[model samples]
Target: MITKKQIDNNTLSDEEIVKRIVNGESYLYEHLMRKFNLRLFRISMSIINDEMEADDVMQTAYINAYMQLSNFQHKSSFSTWLTRILINESLLHKKRKLKQTQLLAAQTDNEYSNDNPLRRLMNKELKVILEKAVSTLPEKYRLVFVMREIEEMSVNETMEILNLGESNVKVRLNRAKEMLRSELSIYYKTNEVFEFNLIRCDRVVNFVMNKINKES
Candidate 1:
């Protein structure tokens, strides 16, 4: 049995490790799990809002990924492929749970406590105001916003993942940004400068490349 300790010290690129697993070296897969578990958990959390369900979704995602590894084409990065699997697993879990709830999966606050600094302000009312501002967004706009802003998926990647046209993606993104700006303008009540940053594809690619190097 592969232990968490061993997973932490694993040494193999995703391609090499996946090949090993496909060749019946299943133990090597523990490294892949370790490498991606946190991210999968976060994505699951975003979709489901429950930690336990997110945990289950993460487990199921890895199982599915392993089963489908043979079909993984190297056209896109392995992380992107794995992320698609994770998102699918998460949405499936969400859909199943929504059968018992009145809420939509995309509208829930599935993020951790530290996700936004505005939430940690001393004024509870201000926090609620911020939540209400975000919560009032239409599901479509919110989904695109969270995927783009929080997950940092590229426009092209998000369009591919959601099977949306470029124009539709742009429209949704523009509407989301406009809504946020409108809300923040009201919240700030002045021309206060806000420092917001976005994660670009190059940074993400470089980070994943470094991880691959360290693993191998």
Candidate 2:
């Protein structure tokens, strides 16, 4: 019974959207997905470091959030709730990937190589260099760096999403910035990192909606 007007209303906050979805207007969940899709994808990519795997993790996280919509308690913003879910899924995926790589005896390379077409392209742009620099950070620092710097999330939001104290969030963010400073002296735009393809966004929306429809 959701209407186009309801979905299109700019004044509708995320909490209101969640309420509508949980109240059985499930078709409106697409609005929530579209709202957080890019941010969640960046979070996934920050952990997984592979485009395809990140996309899978993003989709899985969205599915998990959708299935658990009824249990949402409104303790935090919907974005924070969704982000924690994404972090958990990404960590699990990373663990499984590590085990698989170990089983297959895959060689790990420490040096960045020009063999990767993407890496080659990154070499050509200052903006990509900034992204590559951020990606090179250790996992712990990188997460804080992306949430704080790249995504421009507030410290309070990042701390809540990561379950860290204020001091811990500040320390990690500072360390991440210091690490990047040694490599690049100038600021560059951040929107280019892990750029979400529009076609892929539509695909995820359609896939999730279709799955939800079938289940209902």
Candidate 3:
């Protein structure tokens, strides 16, 4: 895996990298791929809930991106532009796999997903319980929540990725938060308290950001 130090040492800025890619210095594009793969995977996974499919979505998005590279207008951050493509790819996969009954089944089963060992020590046994609750959210709400809350993307960036307007994003985010809070309330017995440790998740955030940056 490429390290941040390696990324920082790379010679080209994003625009420069794009120019190089467009000029047929195709190998430089691999550097971008390495940068953004993780972040894109996370987004794709949040939508599809299938690891292999998420990987496929990321790969397909890149292929589509490379073919359309000449059309990139620099209107949005390169990261946002690439992410939007992946988001669409993931959603398309969801649509193809869509079944009303299966969606309901996944929602009902969301409460029993895996627990990260570290999370147990950080919070109560109920940490994964809350996560499961979030998992049960409708796909639309779930995607927005994960992008904004877990990925910590800015509203504008999210709007670009989700192809939503500012007001729509806000509305969905608010509803998602409300649903999460309500579910957590029940999971915690309405008495057990838990504090989120931002510091612990910093590495995850950095990892995702670097993946996107490199994959770009």
Candidate 4:
């Protein structure tokens, strides 16, 4: 039973934690999953454009990464490697979803309801608007924007994760900002976008923990 105090000591890096898990202290993997759940969720959501599907994509990615943990050579940072797996999973899911939608449309021609942000306005109206604006961005730009601007990852780190050169990363980021600037002038001060609420965070953590425990 890994306690919060053990994880809170914060002395061990991600690499060291992986080593511990590989050495059979499997419970510690929950700490790593919790650490990156929100970032991965945001990443999945940015690509998939559907929250529930994004959640499922993240869960599958985590399970796949854990199963392949031994193959995680020190070629890149653990987060980068995990992110790559997540991106692959999300893209694959997206491809499958597109195919399904095409086939379903051919059969039934059912229409889907547009998610109108105006109807969801509340106290945090600006935040909701900002999230919608970010989500509406073209996929190429949205992922870069979220990784660089929202997650605050460094240029080098973003480049490593996305397999893009610094210039490409900067260019995409600039374009994303330009698009958002036009839409968010009055509401650009707040940085929160696609916030992973605490309840969802705990849910993801518990789901992953339970799955890992059962497998072990």
Candidate 5:
């Protein structure tokens, strides 16, 4: 398990952390979890369309990745590799969720608390506002937008993650920006929509760490 001091000490590059973790320093995996939580959450939300379900997908992805960390070949950045795992898990979860939705009447409830303040003006409510707008986008463009604009990953990484060519990634990103340009212009203050806050961050880290610890 990661100690308190180790959690705040993230001076290592992700590749170094992975190498060490694979060499038996498994507690270091916590650093990777905290570092990529927000990115995974945002991308998962773009695909999954539900925060809670996105969190669930993220947990499964982390656990699966940890169990298979030895297979990472360093062909891509660790973030890209982990993100690919998250994307696959999210897509599979979405398919299963879609079937369940068809059989069961979907009901939505408003229960997200807005206690965090972004720049003293953009609260969680505003974040939700932008999320709803972004969620309205088609999945292909939504994924492109979240990875390119929101998460700020490089085009090459996004292309590899989405299994698209550079041209296709560029085109989809441009189309996504044009579609959301007018709608998101006013919501500029709240650029970060699907933020993975610390509370939820700890919950996910603890869940994954505990699961891996038990299995180890």
Candidate 6:
């Protein structure tokens, strides 16, 4: 009932794609996953602050979204609904990771500083530092920052996804920028940060497709 041209050319709206997928064109789901992979990864990274964990969260979120696709009511755009699901998954995963970290701390003789994950970058290129700067933002501001600035979404879209009022979204975004040191502003490029490269996209798409197919 589907053809390669439809997938390759992306001729359908997201809502149209979702409607078909729910009606038995399940393979069409790959299109949706590949489309939002980058956006979802960055949003999840804003909260998880760890690349590996962010990928893991994104994977789980995609699976959860697919399984619950029938319940989607078209109240919001597909991206907004998917984003809400990702945010919830990210928050739950962060809470669980924190609990695990705290338990490990209690079991050991060492003190805990509650620091963000630290790594020794071989070189502090603008791209690398920009990523570090965003990753280090407090969770509240970080989510708003990614949705508004990096994703270049409108105020209403960001507000809907984040459940924030228009003024609150603006305030949080401004605050997120302020938290980044002045020096970092000299070299700005959001796309360079949290990139989900081609190979990564293929792996995720293949993985999600395989899981969804098994359900059919």
Please tell me which model should have the higher TM-score, number 2 or number 5.
2
lDDT per residue for candidate 6 within 1-216, as digits (tens), equals 346855753667999999999999898988888889999999998999999999999999999999999999999999999999999999999999999999997765233223312222323354688888899899999999998788889999988988889999889988889988664765556776777889779989999999999998
Candidates in order have lDDT scores of 0.80, 0.86, 0.83, 0.87, 0.85, 0.86
lDDT of 2 by residue, 65-181 (tens): 999988999999989999999999999999998998886664333234434555656566857777778888899999999998879999999989999999999999899889999
Q: Which whole-number lDDT from 0 to 100 does residue 118 have in model 2?
A: 58
Better of 2 and 4 by lDDT: 4
- Worst 10-residue lDDT window for candidate 2 reads 106-115
Which portions of model 4 miss their true places by more than 4 Å?
4-9, 109-216
Worst 10 residues of 3 by lDDT: 111-120
Model 4 TM-score relative to the real fold: 0.49
Report the lDDT tens digits of candidate 1 across residue range 1-216.
Answer: 676665534465788777777888788877778888888888889888899889988888888888899998888877899999999988887877777564544334434335755555635776687678778789999888888877899999989989998899889989988997788677664444443335456777889999999999
User: Which residue pairs show backbone clashes in model 6?
Assistant: none
Better of 4 and 6 by lDDT: 4
Instruction: Put down candidate 5 lDDT per residue, 1-216, tens digits, no spaces.
Output: 577666544677788888888998888887789889999999999998999999999999999999989999999998999999999999999999888876564332212223424433546566787888889789999999999889999998998888999999989888887877767766665655677899889999999999999999
Candidate whose lDDT is highest: 4
lDDT string for model 3 (86-201, tens) is 99988988887787668877875553334454544555655667679989899999999999989999999999999999999999999999988887766455344554458658
Root-mean-square deviation (CA) per prediction:
19.6, 20.1, 19.7, 20.1, 20.9, 20.2
Better of 1 and 4 by lDDT: 4
Checking candidate 1 for backbone clashes, the offending pairs are: none
Q: Count the backbone clashes (under 3 Å) in each candidate.
A: 0, 0, 10, 0, 0, 0
